[model samples]
Target: MTLPIVTAVDQAHAAPLRALIDGKAKPLGALGRLEDLAIQLGLIADGPPPTFERALLLVFAGDHGMTADGVSSYPASVTQAMVATFLAEKASANALAKAVRAELRVVDAGVDADLPAHPKLLDEKVRRGSRNAAVEPALTPEEVAEALERGVRIAREAAAEGFELLALGEMGIGNTASAALIMHRLAPAPLVECVGRGAGQDDEGLARKLAVLERAAARSAATDPLAVLAEFGGLEIAMMAGAVIGAASARIPVLVDGFIVSAAALAAIRIDPAVKDYCVFCHRSAERGHQRMLQSLEVEPFLDLGLRLGEGTGALLALPIMRAASRLLSDVASLDDVLNGRL
Candidate 1:
């Protein structure tokens, strides 16, 4: 099916953005990143800063075949176990979602195991797990399309349920490999620069992971991004791309998590660059490659807490900062009000 045409945010609101930021509430440009954030929000909303009433954190869980290569330190079963942890509210994402008052929705994008039915988990599994891209394609084109559709459906449902903002997250072992592939494809940097030690891999493990990805890239050299995604993209990444598109079409702010989510955002941007207008880079992840990815996107994230943990932890941490930015832009008194100089 043809995806809906997602429009970019209105640039015509620049004047109002300046008015809001330069209205003499504080020293000129003293609010720092918060000022820029308020302006960005104004532009995204096409007016003043929007009131984001409800936030939805959608965590897409999947499994990677490359984990069998001993490239990662963690066992492949960790992916499924982590999904279970998310379902049980025992994961970091769950804790952050609770703290931020955001509803967490975990989707089984393509876990290797058959997940038991749970009220909170959306069973949209496309496959048990992807094939090893080191040797062959990870997913078929049909599978990629299915995963993307599942993401779009979920985002639409969340928007309809009154979620004003959406935060993207992922739970998949070996996902950093998928993310590295995406970064290598989208960024100007080469694979070596985009790849990093995920989950604390030793130098040897990192070399093996890089070799596998380099081989994967070489095998898929003549392919486009969709083709590359079919070959190397995880179910979670594809689904996140779909959700980013869906949220942009719905005109909700899309708060992007760290590297993995950024990789999905890169895919979404490839699908439709206009989606960036609705995206907010939540923070700079501690992963070395994430810095290059953010530089490529030309976005300054809200925070930098030396965090490398995915699961939307950084993004959730950023919600309060966004809230504060909106409040300052909309609620704080102007200098004229304080000085009694207004008519």
Candidate 2:
């Protein structure tokens, strides 16, 4: 399937926009990254500070067949249970979204169980779960295409619904293993460096997870974006990548949540380099491989709070920072205005 065309964010207004920010009633660069964020928000909107009256956080949940390999401390059932928690507004993502005044939507990209219908749930399952990557491809090419297409569709729908910012999150048991494998494939990092204590794995469990992922990475050595995703990517990761592309296509800024989301963002960039221009790395995750992924992208995140939880919480926490950035652009008086008034 042909992906949506996403052009680079326009920097034509950079000079005037920067001047507006610099003229704000504060020391030059006193606000630091917030000022930079305002400039980027302006460029993405292609004008004045973009309206973030409504922010949408998409939590894509799926399961990985590799969970059977003992990669996670919890069972695969936790993935669906967490969806229930999200629906009940008990998950961290739900609370943070409420605190930030953003709408939280859950998508069943490829969970292995049948979930109850809910108003907040988007039932867009591509499959029950992905195939095991240690012995075979995680997904067929067709499944990967469907996940990407669904993600693009979901993101476009959110943009149409007036959500100015889209944040990406995911839930899946053993998905960290899948993410590590993808990072290993995409980055030249060692397999051990890509591995981590996913879901609080013990040292022995971590070693086992590492060995599994290392073997999987060696078996599926193709570096092509689609091929790697099919071989090592989870369903939710694939969809999030597609969503990043979709958000860029619609000219909406995307706030990527954490490590898993960052890995998906990398895949999206590999698919289309222009997608990078529209993404805001929301935070630096405490997950082991996340900083490596961020460095490979060569982008600085807005916050780093040692966040390892995945549910879009990190992105939600950064919402106030985003708003503060825009507030400076919209509310703060310019230095010239202040001086003229005094005269």
Identify the leading candidate in terms of lDDT: 2
* Model 1 whole-model lDDT (C-alpha atoms): 0.86
List residue ranges in candidate 1 displaced over 4 A.
Answer: 341-343
Clash tally for model 2: 0
Candidate 2 per-residue lDDT over residues 19-49, each given as its tens digit: 9888877789898778888988888888876
TM-score of 1: 0.96
lDDT of each residue in 116-214, candidate 1, tens digit only? 999889999999888898889899999999888878888888989988889999999999998888788777479999888889999999999899888
Task: Flag clash pairs in model 1.
Answer: none
lDDT of 2 at 170: 93
